[model samples]
Target chain A: MTAPAGQRGRGRPRDPRTDQAILAAALELFTEHGHAGTSIEQIARRAGVGKLTVYRRWGSKDELIAAAVESARGEIPSPGIGDLDGMSYAQISQVIAEALPGSARTLAEPGYRAMLAQVFGSSVTHPGLMAAFWNDHILPRRRTAHLALSRAVDEGVLPPETDIEALIDMTVGAVVYRLLRPEPPDADELLAYLRSVYEQAGMIPRR
Target chain B: MTAPAGQRGRGRPRDPRTDQAILAAALELFTEHGHAGTSIEQIARRAGVGKLTVYRRWGSKDELIAAAVESARGEIPSPGIGDLDGMSYAQISQVIAEALPGSARTLAEPGYRAMLAQVFGSSVTHPGLMAAFWNDHILPRRRTAHLALSRAVDEGVLPPETDIEALIDMTVGAVVYRLLRPEPPDADELLAYLRSVYEQAGMIPRR
Candidate 1:
């Protein structure tokens, strides 16, 4: 239970900022050093907070790391599945175009690449991390992509029998494959590649 | 620099069997516990050999892991670019069809998935490992895929303006994506999905 302002101990006051700082530090540490490499003490040290402060919020390291990764959802783009519900093909394309610059920038970052690698690597051994990632980060984007594909089918751009899941896998997988390469693409290259994949899939019209 | 068998000490003779054992152990350790978690001592212990045996063969952990990863080149399927050269589109498709079963089986294995995750995760942090994997494993396969795509262009299966690299990325990426999912597809499903992506890409004729 969170103590009222008056009932708090003599420790530094806890606020939304403290939670943000702890989560950010956790994400950075987890990205740099994998799940096993990072520890709660390290997170607190990096966050300039007491170990108890982190412990107070999260019951375990997995929980903390899960929260840290979930925090990254805002940094990456999602399809805005609900908003896209009734959008036309052109409208969907516009949303994707506007989002590409930011998505490309984030995906191109070395830190983000490492973070994704860590997450994927942990899937078998550390199921909790992968579960959190899948639920929060992956599912929404996947849903959005599915909706867009459905729209494409309805609009007669893709044949009704088009394997939408396969298309999503290819589009997402291609981006990941590019990122994991020894020489990953830069933002501009990544943007061009994303546009090309979407255009090829008929999700967006070619220029 | 080899001591003749007659000149060898009481220790076990350095032989191909020993090398295989060490490499197998190194790969197993690296897959189970990532690059950072594995150690030479553990590898030796796992292989039932002396620590010096591993050191005598590989100068460092990175070299050992590199060799270990390189040793796996035979396990995964790659396009035989030379064989595919000048072959008809139907011939190319036959080669792919024959290869897909083995590829699907390997890709569906949990151990293979974990190994891939480790290799990809280490790309930025451990370039040496990725370099060896690329040179020994990835490069040949990529070359084969490229040749196949070029053949598709020649056969008029794909448009002349087709982005072969993008198509290749999607196919490989889709397989990898499927493997890393929480509920990864079984061999049969993986085979079907692979066929779908290839068929969609015009790399192989749809049945």
Candidate 2:
């Protein structure tokens, strides 16, 4: 094998492509077979890489899963702080309204829901996976949501004494609960459902 | 082994204690190891019953899990319609307030959360389990919730145009989402959290 320049190690240089392949494999196997059910050997085999190749990058299965989850951070709609900053109330409202359809579509995806199920299901057994998801994915979105709610209060859209955390919890929790139910709504129904929840939470004005 | 009095073309008569033992074993195994990871032999061994006893009661794994889930219904709070039917608005409010502490304690239990996680985690892989949960557990609570919200609207506790279904979704979802978080609140914090959510939703007045 021709060695690429800039490689100081004894083996091949770290390739982004291989990293992606390995992470993807880890996510798929974990999603399908769960945390305990999957192993480094299975992931390496699935990625078509040597076990040493996986071990070199990730010392343990948990570490690899945490990285995979971190990489999959924003599969659901999470409007970042950058996206909301400096936008007028009307502009912010319009952006969220426009985003709802696509967000609903994503929520309706089987793969995404399965991934969430796996994270939750494994939370008690493998706390690291949930911890990774919370730190990397949920915390950022929560901060952005806090910013958005603070802006709403400042703009006099919501009552001054509004419980921002509770509102956010209800809104997000409602959507997730709806998704996890048997015969979850299709994309169109989910869009409508999301709108209703927002309206109920007073996040969006009633239509 | 002596056959009991109700034997009709059967080796041994049905025993309530045997049923309880088998169901308990099934629930425990499923909660710990999940659906695909557990089997009849394991459940039988745990319950100290013959595998044939399990087969005689539930023809398949899915059926056993379904029955176990059905038996475990109402592990969480679900104030029934009958509980609310004759109560004054004030009485209903007091009952709910009194129930909140116990409900919070149940919600904060690790066993309950672990059971919930297993159900959700197995949802994609085992739709039957979720279906049984929905029909046996969630639907009755939904009906009761609808009645309670309706009573509130009728008694002028909520606005006339309140969307009952959306409100219920948000309330139930918020609690579930809170519980599923990495660092779930303790009983006291969960009690406060529940109060905050209800207050925010106008289900209960601000303290």
lDDT of each: 0.82, 0.81
Winning model by TM-score: 2
Candidate number achieving the greatest DockQ relative to the actual structure: 2
On the 0 to 100 scale, the lDDT of residue A14 in model 2 is 88
* Interface RMSD over true interface Cα atoms for each candidate: 1.5, 1.2
Give lDDT tens digits, candidate 2, residues A1-207.
Answer: 122222224365789999999999999988888887899899999999987788777767899999987877666676777888998766676667777887888878777778777887887778888899889867876676677677788899777989999999998889878888878788899999999998777666678
Scored by TM against the true chain B, the candidates give: 0.89, 0.86
Task: Assess each model's interface with DockQ, reporting 2 decimals per model.
Answer: 0.56, 0.67
Where does model 1 exceed 4 Å of error? A1-14, B1-14
Predicted structure with the largest lDDT when compared to the true one:
1
Location of the lowest summed lDDT over 10 successive residues in candidate 1 chain A = A1-10
Worst 10 residues of 1 chain B by lDDT: B1-10
The TM-score obtained by model 1 is 0.89
Docking class of 2: medium
Candidate 2 ranges with C-alpha deviation above 4 Å: A1-12, B1-12, B74-77, B86-88
lDDT of 2: 0.81
Residue A76 alpha-carbon offset, candidate 1, angstroms = 2.0
Cα TM-score per model:
0.89, 0.90
